[model samples]
Target chain A: MIRFENAHIGYDHDLIEAIDFELPNSGIIGLFGKNGTGKSTLFKTIIGLQALRRGNIFIHHQNISEIPGKLLAKKVSYCPTQILSYGNLTVWDVVSNGRIPHLSWLGKLKTHDIELVENSLELMGISDIKQQLISECSDGQKQKAIIASALAQETSILLLDEPTAFLDYPSKQELLKQLSFISEAGKLIIVSSHDLDLFEELCDLKLLLSHHKIITSEDTDFNKYWDEFTTKGLAK
Target chain B: MTTGKLTYLLLGLLLLVLFILGIGLGSADIGFMEAIKSLFKSADSSPEAYIIQELRLPRSLVAILAGAGLAVSGLIMQTLFTNILAGPHILGVSSGASLFVALTILAGSTLGDMSLPFAAILGALTISSLILFASRMLSSGTILLIIGVMIASFCSACVSLLEYYADSSALRSFVIWTMGDFSAVGKTHLPTLAVFVMMSVAICFAFSKGLNALLMGESGAHALGFRVKSLRTWILFITAVLAGSITAYCGPIAFVGLAVPNLVRFIVKTANHQVMIPLVLLTGACFGLLCDIISRLPGDDRTLPVNVASALIGAPVVIIILLKYQKSIR
Candidate 1:
């Protein structure tokens, strides 16, 4: 379970405030907000990439700030929006990096780590292209590679910032199906995306960012709440 | 053997051949067999033995060390900044050493032979610390790179000002040093240079995992639970020590640091640091030996400057590789 208590998330100034909520251990939790609505900042705060200005975040009943980075990595994995394409890293290389926190100092992957990496590649359906350089991969393949990397972490909570951004319509549907499968396998995934229609069909719960606050709603009530929130111009 | 293993074997063999050639084909023109034989002979056995064992051996060893050190430094800087153009000198390390050497030479300091190397190390570390502080204040790698370039330009300006006012003899000595020579390092200074360079290389190898993680950029590495700030600190310190000590002993030999790693990457076609680190080290040693052999010119009594030979050899290889890998270089 992840819980935020009066959390203020932002750099310098709080882009979102009074963010008090508790999420269950497993399911797809859709985070909905327009641009500049603090969706990414909220994700950053939850991953401890950004500090919580005025409140506490509890992961599995333990305060998140108390966890060391390596330990936190085992609990929460994040896939950012922009992926780096400069290095000559192969798909295998990028995906295997997810095992770094668990690997020895030399970063020699043991049998178990290798299996996990392989499984992630298979799960993301990029196993055939494992030897292909990420720089040469298409945008959608790169997106899947990044997601597979996050999956290889085996973290309890996965935070994906626009995982479907570069994906095509069919790939997006396929990814949503994979996320559903991953959530059913007992991981809490909080994904922020602009594709509300698709997420509505997949997400078990919805959290809307409006008026510098996080308002939680059930999947059934998401459309009603979104309508009220949007009609009121609270997104402004 | 697989292609990767074959590449390693070929590189290792090449390095061995270069080492022997570096020791044999000097101004005295000793045969390869004689060079190998002299290694087992006493230092005072004969003029050939003495020259091979005492002078050329240390010179060649220094060449290997400087080459490997500077090349690895370049690799680290390139990976850290994610820029192919980034080299050890990009962070002002060489310029820092150069400025201090300029001060010591032009100021007419009557200090002993050890004073110049000491001054160079001091200047390099001073600049490295300033860079470390600037890295702390700034979060962006591009910004830090700009700051480093600015610092380097400032140091170069200072060196030019020093060169402008110095006497002719002092100016001449400093200019000759700037041209670079492997023979500048005597037998006595070999141990210090070896220790500093070897230790820094080992530390760099130990951080190979972090370096690989850094290929994803700072935020990605941090997300992987690597302490990006601490990693950056270690990288800076290592580069400073390697580049500093080499510049101190070798008078700022060029091209090896900037080109060798790129060549290795282009040939190997992978950014895996574990594979690249050792390859870069060996290739660099080979490059250094090759440059040293060329500089000596075997039969000619007059030696070409090591820097000139390195540039002459390195520039063409770099240009060709850059053209071939233009799409991937960015």
Candidate 2:
């Protein structure tokens, strides 16, 4: 379980709150927040890339800050908003790089490692284009390649920021379907996304970041609370 | 083999021919047939044999090492910055070394081989410290690059100042080194240069995964379990050594670093640093040797500096790379 306690994050002079949050035991959680709600910063903190002004982040009951680089990789994975710019790498190479945390500086993969990479490729449905250069891949395929790399990491939890931002309507829905399918296997999945219509159908939990309310069940009255919350904010 | 492997192999073979040409021909003009005979047995006793063994052979080896070192440095710079055009020169490490070298000469320090390389390395480390400081404190790669270039231009200005004040002898030596000449490398210096190149190349190759992780940018690499800060530190350290000594011995050779990694990526199409590292080494050696051949060809009474030759060649290749392959560099 990933847990955060009174995490106070600040950028330059401005401070985001000292808020506490925890991962639910199962399924997809939608981080529903407008731009500049500190969602991206929080993701960086959870991944142990950024230092916290207050509180601690615990992964699998162990503090994430204390883990080594390779070990951290074994436990957590993240997909950022910015696309990677590496020259001349094929789709196969990018996905296989997920195994780096498991390998040594001089490490090459064992057969099991190769199998896992193949599995990731197959799951992402990118096998036919595994040899295709990244420069040659389409937008959807490129998005899937990023997802495929996350899958190859085989972490218990996956964190993504705006995974569907550049994708088309069908691609967004397809990614939502994929995320839902992934979460069903008892993995903890969290994605910060903006597709409210797709989230309603596919998400198990909805978190309204700006308003500070979390809806933990599918049966939660999102419509009622959302209307009331927006009205209250306007009155202020 | 795939096209990538086949192209690298051909490049390797082409490098071998250039290597032979490097030993066979020079300003003295041994001529190919006689040079081969001299290799077998002092050329049936020619002054040519001593020149080849004592001068050209070591010089050629230095040329290879400098090329390979600069090439690998370019590879790491591109990976670290996540920009295709990024290289040691672009990032100002080379500039830092250039300034240090100019200062060393200006300070009345008549440097030996070891001291010259050592001073250059120290200078490069200083620049890396500045780049790292910006990368950590600012969280901006672009800012780091801009700062680096600013420092580099500052160094270039200093170099010009040094050029103006120096007497003819010092100025001549400085000018020759600046143009990246390998013809002056001595037999005694080859072993140390060789050891340095091999060890640094091994270290650079060892960081292949870290480099690949780096290409994905810092945050993504952090998630994949890489200590991104540490990895960047190591890569920068290795690049400094690879580039510094080459600059110390010869002068700052350009574009080979900027060109070789892109060239390898175009051929290999695998961003995995594992494959990219070895290919970069091979291709870098190939590039250096080829450039050396053009610089040292028989017609000129005084051989051209390798840098001048590489720039004439490298400028076109880089332009073509940018013009034709716009999407790949990204």
Query: How good is model 2 by TM-score?
Result: 0.90
What is the Cα-based lDDT of residue A121 in candidate 2?
A: 90
The candidate scoring highest on lDDT is 1
The DockQ for candidate 2, computed on C-alphas, is 0.63
- Where model 1 places Cα greater than 4 Å from the true spot, the runs are A219-225, A228-236, B107-118, B125-154, B328-330
Model 2, A27-81: lDDT tens digits are 7877766667677877787787877777777888888778776777787788887
Q: Write the per-residue lDDT of candidate 1 for residues B1-330, one digit (tens) a residue.
A: 299899899999998988898888867868999999999999999999999989999989988998898899888877876666567676777889888888987878532366776788778878877876776677566677788789989998998888888888888878878888888787988988899899999999999889988886666787788778888877877887888878877887877887899889776767778888898999999889888988987467788899989999988977886676565554
What would the TM-scores of all predictions be? 0.92, 0.90
Q: With candidate 1 superimposed using the best TM-score fit, by how many Å does residue A89's alpha carbon deviate from the native? A: 1.7
Q: Score the docking of each candidate (DockQ).
A: 0.60, 0.63
